[model samples]
Each structure stands twice: as C-alpha cells, then as structure tokens.
Target chain A: MDLTFAPEEEAFRAECRAWLEANVPRGLPSGDTRDGFGVHLEWERALYGARYAVVSWPEEYGGRGASAMEWLIFEEEYYRVGGPQRVTQNGIFLLAPTVFEFGTQEQKDRILPRMAAAEDLWCQGWSEPNAGSDLAGIQSKAVRDDAGGGWRLSGQKTWTTRGAFCTHLFGLFRSDPEAERHRGLTYFLVPLDAPGMTVRGFGRLDGDEGFAEVFLDDVFVPDTDVLGEVHQGWGVAMATTSSERGLTLRSPGRFTATAARLIELRRERADPHDTRLRDAVIRAWTDAEAYRWQTFLTVTRMSAGEQLGAESSMTKVFWSDLDVRMHELALELLGADAEHDDSGWMKGYQFALSGPIYAGTNEIQRNVIAERVLGLPRK
Target chain B: MQFAFTDDQLAFRDAVRDLLARECPPSVVRDAWTNKHGRTDTLWTRLGEMGVLGAALELTDLDLVLVFEESGYFAVPEPIVEHVAVAVPLLPEPTRAATGAITAVTSLEGQGAVAYGNSADVVVAGSDAGVELLEAFEVTTLPNSVDGSRRLGQVSSSGTGSGVQIGDRDVFRRAFDRGALGTAAQLIGLTRRMLDMTVAYVSDRNQFGVPVGSFQAVKHHLADARIALEFARPLVYRAAWSMSEEDPDASVHVSMAKAAAGDAANLTAAKALQCHGAIGYSYEYDLHLFMKRAWALAAAWGDASWHRSRVGRAIL
Candidate 1:
C-alpha cells in the first residue's frame, strides 16, 4: 500500500529529469506533419544516444535495464518536462517486446539496436479493410518460396499506424490456408523497400498521414524474418496486443500530463464560478490519478512476477474511454472556440476520437473482458 | 511499493466474508427489513464481539477498508460504517464500548436524520466548539427511509440528555474522511456483487433462442459496469493507503475515491436491475436488496457532487 518511491527510483527520476531538461529538443516538429515527422525521428535518435529511449530493456538492447518502477518514474519525469511523444513508439513499445520474446538471438542482436536508434522505423500491420475488430478475419496470405528459401507475402494491411514514415512492418499472414482461423497464421517482418511493396498514406481524423495502407505484392521475406513458429501467429500477436493495450502504449504519465494541462486550460480560460467545467476538470484529474495509481499497482504486481492476462482488456477500455472524455471536457471548456480555434485542444480532440477504435475497438475489448475476465460464455 | 493486501489483511477479509455468508444471507437481510429497528441486535452484538466496530481505533486504515468492503458486499443492515469509520475515531476509548450503531451529523442544520438514528446509542455531531456525542434519546427520531434495511430519523437540538465533547475540528474532519472512504469501499464491493449477479443471470437466461449474455448489448452494459468497478477499486484502495499513511493529500484522495465509486456503483445497480428485467423490480428479489443499499450508500456520507466539489476545491 506504500506509494513512496525507493531512493534509487527517486535518483533515477532526478537523472531523467536532468537529462530531459538539458537535451530535449526545442521547437521540434509536432510529428503530426510530414516535416515534423523527420524531426520526431531525430528526437528518438537523440533519446537513444542518451540511453533514455527504452528504459526497461536490457543494457545490450541500448536500454538502462531499469526496473518497472524506475521506468514509471522516468515516464513521470519525462512527461512532466514536456517531452515529445516517442516517434519510435511502434518499434519501442509494441514490437520490441515481441522481438525480445520471440525473435531469435540473431534477430535481437540485429534489430533491437537499430530500432533503438530509429535507424529502422517500424509500424504495425494488424488490421485490414475487412478485418478491423475481427483480426482473425485477415485475408493476407504468405506462401513458401521453395526456390528462394523464403516466403512470398501478399496482403494489404490498413490502418497501419506510422506507416507513412516507417521503413519496416511486422504483420500476420495466413501461412497455412487450409487451417481454421487464428491457427495457421504466421508473424513476419517485411521491409517496405522490398520489390512490389507500396505504402499509400491516408489522412487520419486529426488530418495527418500518420496512418497508411501498406500493400505487399508478393514481397519476398527470408525465413529469418519469421517472428515465431508458422501457423502460431495468433499466440505471438497476442503478446504484442497485450503490450500495446496493457503496458507501454498508454502510460499513465501521458494522461497525467494531459490532465494537468486541462486544469491549466480551465484556470486560464474558463470562468472560475462555472461549476460544470469545474466538475469536469476535477473528474479529469481524478480519473488520471486513478489510472496512475492503477498503473502503479500493475507495475508492482509485474515487478513481483505476475502476469496481467486478459485484464489488460479492462485497462484498454478504461483509459481509452477516459482519454476521450478528458479531451471532450477540454473542448467543452473551450466553449465557442471548441470548433473553430487553432488551439492544440482541437488537434487533441480529433486524436482522442481514435483511442477506442485502435488497439482493438472498445466493443471488441469488452467482449474480451466479458469472456476472459468475467468467464462469460462467448456469443 | 506494494499495493496488494498482505496475507494478514487477506485473512481478515476472508473471515469477514465467512461471517457475512453465514449470518447475513438474503433471508436474514430480508428479515431485517421487517424488523422493528430495521436491523438485528444479534448482528450488532456479534460485530462488536468480533471487534469490527472498534476497528476505526484498532486496525489500520487499509485493514478497515477490507472490512468495510465485506460489510458492503453482504449489504449488512447495521450502521457499521457510522460506528467504525466515523464515531469511534472521533470519540474517546472510554465511550467507544458504550456506543451502539453510531450515526453522523454532516451538517447541524440539515435534515439532521442519520442512518439507523433510532437504533443508535450515540449521536456524534461536529460543530464549531468540538465534536459532541449525544445519546439517541437526546435527538428526536423520525423513521422510514428509502432504504428500509437501516432506520433513519430526523433529529432536533432540544434533547434532555447531556452531551460529551470528545474531540476537536481536526479529529472530526478525519472521521468524516474515513466515513467517506469507508462508503467508497462499500460501494465498490456492492458494485462487484451487482456485476456478478447480472453476469450470472445473463448467462443462464435466454432470449431470442440464445443466452442473453451472448448478446453484445447485454455484454457491453455488464462490461462497462465491470470497467467502472475495476478502475474504481484501485482508487478506493489507494485512498485507504493514503489515509493509512496519513498523507497530507489523503482527504482529496478519499473524495476522489468516493466520487468514482459512487458513480460506478449507481451505474452497476441500474445495469443489474435492467439486465434482470421485471424480476429485479420486485421487492422479493435479492437484487433490490443490493440496489436499495447502493442507492442509500451513494447518498450517505457525501454524495458524488459533494465529493467532486471537494476535489475541485483542492485541485482546481
């Protein structure tokens, strides 16, 4: 029940804050635009150079090998200092865990350092035009290239986050077409530069091409590119999804910072006596603090070697919904300027709309919660 | 830092759960509704014997949190929250044993009725001078509340009995926060029970030739309720933890926990009742027992708006 940090964790936080205050790039691009995307990539490289990119990974992987609590402290300090969003998030948070868990020694030794340095920007390829929430409904296929000792991958993965700038993608493909859903799929990493591969960027709700449709037309991938056993992609992909929804993707620090900003906005622009706005502001802060406490609880358990399991679905539902509500409250506080203003609140409002839709829709997350956490029968 | 309860705390929880399972069954809860004072003296005596009533002074805040949760889960008809979380902490040790089902006075000028007011042996009210403990006979009692499990009464200032001034404003403030935090924990426990009941019912009951639980609408409703409860649980526990540590921000944390848990518990009651359909509406059903308890507890201590205002004052 203790909330106080250990001395070492506090020292680590101080170090992180000191480094961020000294080295964090100023007037950097927002990463929502094409020009800013490159600057964001460079910022990630700078983070890697400072050994602050992946705090929880092993030192060999260019991380500090910090404990989970220290990592949380790093985040708290990082966000407090107004650190830019991690541009290498897809590579660092989602895919890196899978690579560490399922990649061969050769793969880890080869890919992780490059990933940490932003030399090989990565994007996820989980959903398609037809397989949004129903991930197993993916029609992507990969056939073994016996002559070349590789596989010929052909698929169109839509909603590929950061696909416009990423040089590589890791996706699930139907390796054994004869098998039923989720059984015969294979997890593979493909280079976007491979022959016959094209990335067509799409505008997101925030009017940014951060998301793209990646088309793989018989792109050749070596056997070394396979993440895990063929026909066992679902199990491997679940690992990444859990990390995406559960741990690193939406850290409590982001919401805490956002909540602090919302309060600032209310104090600066909102009427002091407006009880409705006051209540919403308070709720936003409370929800964010609740999330922070919950994450602390989660980190403590994980530090003690506990597995999070399908309970991550509940976390996904909670933060995603809270993020949207917080953003909405920010907009409400903006009042008439909510729609027409060029404030950061407008962009955040647009971005918050996608939280529930991504990492599996809230609807799908609920089904997962109901079936796995509550032991309810599947529909 | 560890957030999970220790083995001893868990054992205490299990003991409370076992006691409630054995003594506070649905039949017994239903009987309490019809009793003269809307609660059983035996249960109160057993609680006192178990030292549950004295936990405010004896147990750590975290331990009392686990205890209060079980009280809420069982929908215990007694004024345990008022006794353990509020009165005992404000009153001195010599008077604690003499107190029977203590009720709170949030405002001296308000309706002045407290839960189980008629049954209380002690009426503790905080005022400008100090915290005062008056005998139940000192305050006029008006019975019949929305929640029938515990009797409620309106009190007036003119009573014949002399009062005992035990503590000051700070002591009373801490007791108030404890009462709110206790109610928050109870709301969370009550929400868990409501969600569990609905989950079980939806799985067994079929509609349109399929189990209703399989329907996304029903599942989503239950799922939202579950998410709310899950998120609120940590807040309640952390609030307890904060209070146990005597953190300066403990009051704010308690208010946050109360606001979140009250909103979540009310939603759980509504969703559970809606999922149960017609059967849930009947007084004969067990769902109403918890539903009524949820309504009562949500308004008790400090309601959602009251707590939210507290949070706004602190943070905003």
Candidate 2:
C-alpha cells in the first residue's frame, strides 16, 4: 500500500533530476533521421559517460545495478527534463535484456559495454515483407558452414528500424530446413558491414530515414555471434518482443511528461472558454496518470517475483492508443497551423501513429490478450 | 513503492467477499427492488457486525476501499459507501460506535436527493457552513431510479432542531473525497463483474456453430473492456493510497480515479450488453444487474465529465 518512494529512492531521484536538468541537450533533431541519428549517438555517449545510460544493469556492465523502481524513477526524471529519445534503445532496452538473460559470458562481456557506450549501434530485424504480424513466418535462413566455422545467412528483412545507420543487428533465422514455424530457428548477431549484406534506407511515414530493408546474400556470421542455443531462437525472440511491448520500451514517465507538456500547451494557446478541448486535455492527462499508477502496480508485482507474460499485450494496447490520442488532441489545439508548424507536435503525431502498428500491431496484441489473458477460445 | 494490499487487508476483503457471496447474491439485490425498506435488514446487521460499517474508523483508506469494491462486486443493496465512507466518519464518538444504525448523507446547500434517505436511521447534511447530524428529517421519496434498489429521497429539517452541528467545511470536503473514492472502487467492481459475466457467457454460448468467444470481433470487444478495467484499477488503488497518506493532491487524485473508473465501467457495460445481445437487454438476464449498478454508481457522487472538469481546473 506504500506509494511514496523510500528516502534513498528520493535521493536517487534528486540526483537524476539534477543531472538531467543540467545536461539534457536542447534543440536536438529527431533521432530517426540520418543527421539526427549521429547527434543522438553523441548524446548517448554523453549519457554513458555520466553512468546514466543503463541504470538497471549490473555495475560491471556500465550500470549502477539500480532496482526496477529506481529505473522507473530514472526514466521519469529523464523524460521530465525533455531528454532526447534514446538512440541506443534497441540495444539498451530491447536486445540488452535478452542478451543478459540468454547470452553466454563471452557474449555479455563483448556486447554489453559497447552497447552502453553506443560504440556499436543496434537495430532490430524482426518484420519482413511477408512476416509482420506472423513473425514466426520468417523466410530468413542460416545454413551451417561447418568447414568455415560459421553460418551463411540469406534473407531480406524489411522494416528494420534504423538498420542503415546501425553497425549491428540481432534477428532470428531458420537454421534447420526440415523444422517449421517457431522451431529450428536460431538467433544471430550480424554486422551490417558483412561482405554480402546491403542496407537500403527508406523514408517512413514521417519521412525520416528511420526504416531500412536489409538484404543478406549469404552474409556470414561466425559461430561466436550466435545469441542462444541453435534452434531456440523462437524462445529467445519472445523474450525480446515482450521487452519491446512492455515497460522496458515504453515507460509511463514518457506519457506523463507529454501530458504535462500538453497541459502547458493548453495554458499557452487554448481558449479559456473551450470546454470541449479542456475536457479532452484532462482525459489525456488523467489517462497518462492512470498509466503511471498502472506501471507502479506492475513493477510492484514484478518485484514480488510475479512473471509478466501475455499481460504485457494489455500495456501495449493502452499506451499506444494513449500516445495517438494525446498527439491528436495537441494537433487539434494547433488547428490549421498544425499542418505547417514545426513545433514537434506534428512530428510527434506522426511518430505516435506508428505505436499501434509497430511492437506488434494493436490488433495482434488484442488477440493475444483475448486468447491468453482472458482465456477466450482461439480460432 | 509497493502498490498492493497487505495480507491482512486482502484477507478482510476476501472475508467481506465471501460473506456477500453467501448473503447478498443477485436474488437479494432483486429483493431490494420490491422489499419494504428497499434493503435487507439482516445483511446490514451482518455487515455492521463484521465491522464493515466502522471501516473508516479502523482501517486505512487503502483497506477501506477494498470493502467498498467487494460491496460493489455483489451489487449490494445497501448504502455502504454513504454510511461508512461519508456519514460514519463524521459522527460523534458515541454515535460512531452505533455501527448498526444506517446513516445516509447529502449536500446541505444543494439539498439534492439523498441515496437511501428514506430508510436511513439518520441523515448527515453537509456544506461549507458545517455538518449537521439529523435525528429525524422530512423525507419526500423521489421518482424510482433506473436502479430500483437505489431509493433516493429529499430530506428537509423537521425544525425540531434535532440537527446537531458536528464538523466544519474542511472535514466535509474530505468526507466528499472519501465518498467519491469509495464510489470509484465500486464502479471498478461492477465493471469487473460485467466483464466476467460477458466473458463466461461468450465462452459457453455458440453462434454460427462455434463459441461466440471464438469470434475475433467478440474477443476484441471483451479485450478492450479488460484493458479499460486493468488501467482503471490501479488509479483507484493509487487514489486510495493518496487519501490514506493525506497527500495535498488527494482531491485531484480522487477526481482522476473517479473519472477513470466511471469511464471504464460505462464502456464495459456497453460492450457487455452488446456482446450479450437480446438476453442482456431483457431484465430477466443477470448481466443487467451489474450494468444497472454501474450506471447508477458512475453518475452518483459525480459523473466522469464532472470529475474531469475538476481535474482540468487543477492541471490546466
């Protein structure tokens, strides 16, 4: 029933708030763009130097080994000061957790420090032209080259976010031809600079070079680059996708900060008499607060050793919808000017549009919630 | 921060839940619609005996909300929120000890209809001026509500000066917040019950030679309802904690909880009815019990729009 942070947690929060307030860069470009990605990487390096890059990881891995609660507090402080979106999230949030869980000691030592320092930027390679929602329908294959002491990968992975800019990728590939759908897959860490690989950057809906199609023509990945056991990538990939969908990727502090900004925006621009818009702002703000408390409840359960499984789908559906609605309301407040303005509202609105579509479509998440959380019959 | 109930608090909730399951089933709720006093006396006594009526005096706001939520789960035909959360807390020490006495509350200046006013042993009228405990008051029963079990009445002082001033405006405001928080908890319970019934119904009933729950459309509808409840539940609990800690922002937090819980309950009821089809439309089906309770409770202390306005004033 305790809701207030402990004294030490408060001290940690104060320390984070002071550091973020002092050092968070201003006027940084969108991290999704080519020019912006480079600047964002510099910011990531600055964060790493301050030991603020991976607060929840062990100290040996360039983190403070902070608790989950402290991690949430750090996120709160980070977003409260308008910290730039983490350019290293794919490596730090999504892939790093899986690597820590499943990676061998050699893999952890090699991958983690570089990841924290943003020395080797990483992007995901999950969705393809034919395998968006049906992720297990991956057509990518990794054939063993026993004599060469490696695997030869051949596949076309589309919608590989930031793949063109990233130095490395972590993805699933079929390693056993006879096995089908979720079996016989192996997780691989591939370098974009491999001899047979080419990454073609493309414009997303927001017109940023945030999307890339990675074409692999027998690109070789050494045996040491294998993430987990052979033919166990499906299990390994599920762990990463859950992190993608859950609190690790989208903490409540992000939305609450946006909600606070929305309130300030209303105070500055909106008509005092516009009750309709006022109510909408309140709804958005209240929902954001609700998400905050819900995250607290979740972290509390996790701290108590409860496993978060299919329920993360519920969190995904909630925040993705909330993000879109909050941004939509901001646009409406901007009215006609929204179409031409560069206030980042338009950019944010465009980015929020992708929340439901990526990290598994809301439709797919709903199916997961219905079938798994509610125990509803599946077709 | 730990955002869960303690074992003792949870045990209390389970005990209340079990008692309601045995004593305050749907049939008993149905009975209230036709019963003489619009309530069953025995269950009230049982609740009082269980110290539920005195929860505000003993338990923290966090523990007290669980009782209110369980009462909502059963759709109990009693003014537990009014009597326990609002009225009893303001009573004089000796009066507070009389747990079995039914005490309803209403705004003194607004003088709106009081829930369970006609049947209550006493009515606490409150406003910025002060709080007054009325021993006997004139009561004019209002029109029958959408929820038949929820009987409202207009209360006016009979001029015998039996009304004793007990507390001041600040105390009254806190009581109002508690009432709002308790109602929010109840709305959450009602929302859960409706979603559960709809889930069970869809899982067993077949249409097009397959279980209705097998349909993606039905699954999505139910999932949306579940998502609404899941997010709303924590807000309610956090509000309880805020109130328990007497945070300076407790009023706004309570407003957030009420608004979110109200919206969740309304949305769930609509989706539950739509999924239940014609059976839910009929009074004969049990789903309407929770749906109707949700409707009344959501709009009772303050509707979603009203609470959102309160929140907007604070933040915007």
Q: What is the C-alpha lDDT of each candidate?
A: 0.83, 0.89
Docking level of model 1:
medium
Which DockQ value does candidate 1 get?
0.76
> Which regions of candidate 2 deviate over 4 angstroms?
B93-98, B101-112
Candidate 1's residue-wise lDDT over B1-316, tens digit each?
7778888899988988888888898788888889887886577767766767776666888988988998888888887777777776666543444244344433222112577766656567765456777753444555566677767665544466546777777777777787789889999889988988889998999888888898888888888898888888899999999999999999999999999999999999999999888988987889988988898888877788888998888887
Clash count list over all predictions? 1, 0
Question: Candidate 1's C-alpha lDDT?
Answer: 0.83
lDDT of 2 by residue, B188-258 (tens): 99998898899899999998999999898999999999999999999999989999899999989999999
Best candidate according to TM-score: 2
lDDT of 1 by residue, A129-171 (tens): 9888888988999999999988999979998887888899999
Residue A100 of model 2, lDDT score: 94
> Which residue pairs show collisions in model 1?
A1-B2
Per-prediction DockQ: 0.76, 0.86
Candidate 2 docks with a DockQ of 0.86
